[model samples]
Target: MDAVVKALSARVDAHDAGEKIVHRPTREEAEAAVRTLIAYAGDDPDREGLVETPKRVAKAYRELFGGYEEDAGTVLAKVFEDVEGYGDMVLVRDIPFHSHCEHHMVPFHGSAHIAYFPSKGVVGLSKLARVVDVFARRLQTQETMTQQIADAVEDALQPRGIAVLIEAEHMCMSMRGVRKSGSSTVTTVFTGIFREEPAEQARFFTQVRLGK
Candidate 1:
């Protein structure tokens, strides 16, 4: 069992290492790109009012895309086996998050609900929220973000089942094409028992919708 765990851990480490950017642009370059976009928008980049806008935008990009520097596996590394033999679904709901739409590079704000059935080990509850944030801080589609959260939890805990649901309002939809204001998008992903058992899936959804 130790060998198996070590092997899995090594694989996860390698995967995370591979995901890192090798030749990323410098801060100055990023600021330059932002200036270019400002100019393209018919603004004077050198004007007094806009002189610092590119630097500010570049700084904001660092925060918005910070997930690229995080590893979900690392956040989920610590697990507790002292659950007192509690073996049932553990759900965390209403975890608010902000992400950029990969398609339009606009903002999307949402809440995520995650649930998992542990076998012998359980992770810290806050780690689940951290997992959500790690994925949420990246450029993503609602559908892809949901699945990524589910997959990250499953990979870390080896849970018997996992389910993830995300509901979000996309600025691209409301401010651009279609202009469907107040409309939200939802995406769900189920794995293991959540995928195999209809009753379990229903229970997960019920728990997720309990107060919302």
Candidate 2:
């Protein structure tokens, strides 16, 4: 099941990899594609209000999918060695983010809680939030994004342990399929000590849900 899921995600990530590698489409081409979609959806692309819609959507796509242009490692590259030898678990919770559903191209909005045991030094608190945003700004499945965020942090910091929990409401389920509104999905990834120690996992869960 895990292998199948990974395969599916890889396909989604490489939707147009061939074209992208050869020659990415220009802004005009993107706008034209949007216009084609508008027409296919039974809308008049030439209509005054909709005439400019394609352009707007194309522009929005750049901002919405900008994560593809960023590297999480770069964001986490700088570390602070001045922790005064303070070695402990650091937790950041209630990080709000929104991402497009890779399957339906809709949206899923959520919060991510991250915890890590610093092996050597510590990173800026804001860097963690930035990490969440970096992944959130891309087309994703909650499960895949959860793993990606955990992997990115683990690779960059080489922490003793890392835990990532994400809770989200996928619009694909509510807006289209089952139509079950107000339903949220949660996904988590634990590495190293967090994976080995049940107590640490329990502590993470407790802290994440402490007030909420």
Candidate 3:
């Protein structure tokens, strides 16, 4: 296993993308590494209690972070031409998500609120969730993730305004660092009219905060 790690590490080093290497080990390699971790932790991975744990974890990852395999534009590409020129803020709230924090590779569970006012056309509500998924799938901080959601919506639709709010609990903080069980992180991003017009932003915020 050490030899395998050495070979893989060499490959990542050779193809290093930047300061924080974005190496994606193959599924087989990832599962093998998980098996090694189970063994290293003094667990008999082949035992009935743990027999399929590695495979399960790997498969779970494929689902949890599947955004990498999808394109955000494809999801939002369909736009409505005839809103009859009815322009108003389109708000989508409580879009559920679970992402891994790049810092600790631990879960950060949350719901997102996305809002945008179309200038010429509008996208469906579900596309808002797809926009969130793209940034969430990769290593992220809440601040950057929030901005990404807003920016993508604006870039896609040339909207009059864009707002994104994220509220999450970081397992890295709750389960390990300081271990504060109830601590929650909230972040927001606003642009265009949402930034210039206070009332518009407030309207979006008020709606997302309801039933929170």
* Cα-based lDDT at residue 158, candidate 3: 90
In model 2, where is the ten-residue run with the lowest total lDDT?
Answer: 5-14
Q: What is the C-alpha lDDT profile of model 3 across 90-133, one tens digit per residue?
A: 88899888888878888898999988888979987777877788
What's the residue-level lDDT of 5 in candidate 1? 28
TM-score of 3: 0.84
Q: Whose lDDT is greatest here?
A: 2
- For all candidates, the clash counts are 0, 0, 0
For model 1, residues 33-80, the per-residue Cα lDDT tens digits are: 989999999999999999999889977876887786688999999989
> What's the residue-level lDDT of 186 in candidate 3?
95
Q: What's model 2's lDDT at 201?
A: 95
Task: Give a tens-digit lDDT track for model 2, residues 15-68.
Answer: 343634323466778899999999999999999999999889978987897777
Model 1: how far is 29 from its true place, Å?
1.0
Question: Model 1 TM-score?
Answer: 0.89
Tell how far residue 163 is off in model 3, in angstroms: 0.7
Better of 1 and 3 by lDDT: 1
Better of 2 and 3 by TM-score: 2
The per-residue C-alpha lDDT of model 3 at residue 141 equals: 75
Candidate 3, residue 140: Cα displacement in angstroms equals 2.6
